[model samples]
Target chain A: MEIIISILLLSGSFFIFLSALGIIRFKDLYSRMHSTTKASSFGLLLLLVGVSLFFNELNVYVKTILVVVFIYLTAPLAAHAIAKSYREKDKE
Target chain B: MAINNIVLLLSFSFLIVAFILAFVRLLLGQGIYNRIAAMDLIASIVIGFVLVYAVFIQMGLYIDVAVIISLVAFLGTVAVSIYLKNNTNKNDGDNH
Candidate 1:
């Protein structure tokens, strides 16, 4: 159990680390947005899963799942909004 | 137990590095969009930090805080995104 949680935490942080690195390394707005939006979402997902595993109570499990789902539903929309605005502003 | 401590330590270090990188982008980004993205990234990484802290201390209340942070961050993203769209549209008339 501990091993599984540890693995999740390590891997999630790694994902976030890579995501941040990409944000710095990428040269464009779209590329930076891509890296931050996708990688961080996944990183959050893994972290939530690991956390819920440790807690494992009904309420905590539900709350964790809710947060993960909310992030998934909103993150892409936020990225899309930014990208669309970028296009709108830059094209003119 | 020792393994858990090691894992948590590794996670904290990684998250700190992530924060630093994102902060660099936030500071040096050429465009406002890049800065916005960096801010968003920081929020997500902080959420990761909250999660790790929760597990490290074996506390359930901390998870609730994590949930609230995520919710607030999402709202912020939406608000900023809407503002960006409106601002862009307003500027489009004069841009070209």
Candidate 2:
């Protein structure tokens, strides 16, 4: 189970790293936002799950889960807002 | 119910890779906005690293720090965006 958890976590983080690299390599603001949003969201979610497994406390697990949920809900909205502003600015 | 040491090793390597990519962005970005965006990525990656560290070290406070970092990153991005827009507008007005 631990190996399973680690595989999940590492895979997600690898994607996160790739995404951040894409952010640097991509020239457009929209493209960067896409990479950041998808990669970090999954990466952080895996991290939270890995921590929860490593520590068997109920409170911390719940809190970690909540944080993951909140991030999922908020990250896309934040990215959208940023992208919208960037596009609007480009238009002007 | 026990975690393998290999898991820890893999997680650490992944984090280091992410950190390096984010660092490259921070160093090589062409302008203020790009740099700011890279900083945002750094903060996000740092939060992941912090959570993993908390697990390895059995520290609860690290999650609290991650929470605070998230809040601050959001605000900082907004503040920088406003500043950039305002500065650009001022430059545009000056040109006219």
Candidate 3:
């Protein structure tokens, strides 16, 4: 179980590391947003699942799950909002 | 347990490296939008760091704090977006 948890966490960290890479490598706003949103959300999902699974207590698991859900809901919306602003700014 | 510690250390190192890269990108961004995107990435990476630290230390408080940080970070991004929108529109109107 510990091994499984560690692997999950490490893989998640790798995804986030890639997300950071994307932020640096991508030239424009849209591509950067695409990389940041997808990679980070997936990374966060994995990390939350790994941590929650390791904890036996019910509430901790529940809280982590809620946090995951929160990230899922907010990430895309925030991305959209920022992208829209970028577009609007561009039109000017 | 020792292996787990080593794994955690490696993960932390990766995150720190990523964070530093993102910070450099933020500094070098050509425009305000790029800067904002880099800033957003920075916040997410920091949240990732906090979370791994929390789990490494087995602290419940850090979990809650992570949640709060995520929410606040989201709010900040939205606020910046709105500010950018208004700023652009105002500039356009002034030019016209």
Native contacts kept, each candidate? 0.81, 0.43, 0.60
User: Between the candidate structures 2 and 3, which one is better when assessed by TM-score?
Assistant: 3
- Per-residue lDDT of model 1, residues B5-95, tens digit only: 8889999999999999999998998988888888889989888998888888888889878888888887887788779878778777668
For candidate 1, give the lDDT of residue A43: 87
Clashing residue pairs in candidate 1, if any?
none
Comparing to the true complex, what docking class would candidate 2 get?
medium
What would the per-residue lDDT of candidate 2 be over residues A27-88, giving only the tens digit for each residue? 87778888888888888887777777767678777788778877787777667656655654
Worst 10 residues of 1 chain A by lDDT: A83-92
Best by lDDT: 1
The DockQ leader among the candidates is 1
Report the lDDT tens digits of candidate 3 across residue range A1-92.
88888998899899999999988888778999999999988988888887777665788788888888889999999999889998887765
Q: How much lDDT does candidate 3 score?
A: 0.85
Once fitted onto the true fold, the runs of candidate 1 whose alpha carbons sit more than 4 angstroms away are: B1-3, B91-96
Task: Give residue B4's error in model 2 in angstroms.
Answer: 3.2
Question: Each prediction's Cα lDDT score?
Answer: 0.87, 0.75, 0.85
Model 3 complex DockQ against the native = 0.69
Off by over 4 Å in 3: B1-3
lDDT string for model 1 (A1-92, tens) is: 88888898899999999999999898889888889888989988888888888888899899988998889998998898778877878776
Rank ordering of all candidates by TM-score, starting from the highest: 3, 1, 2
**Which pairs clash inside model 2?**
none
TM-score of chain B of each: 0.86, 0.89, 0.91
Q: Please provide, for model 2 over B43-69, each residue's C-alpha lDDT reduced to its tens digit, 9 standing for 90 to 100.
A: 888888787777667776677777777
TM-score of 3: 0.95
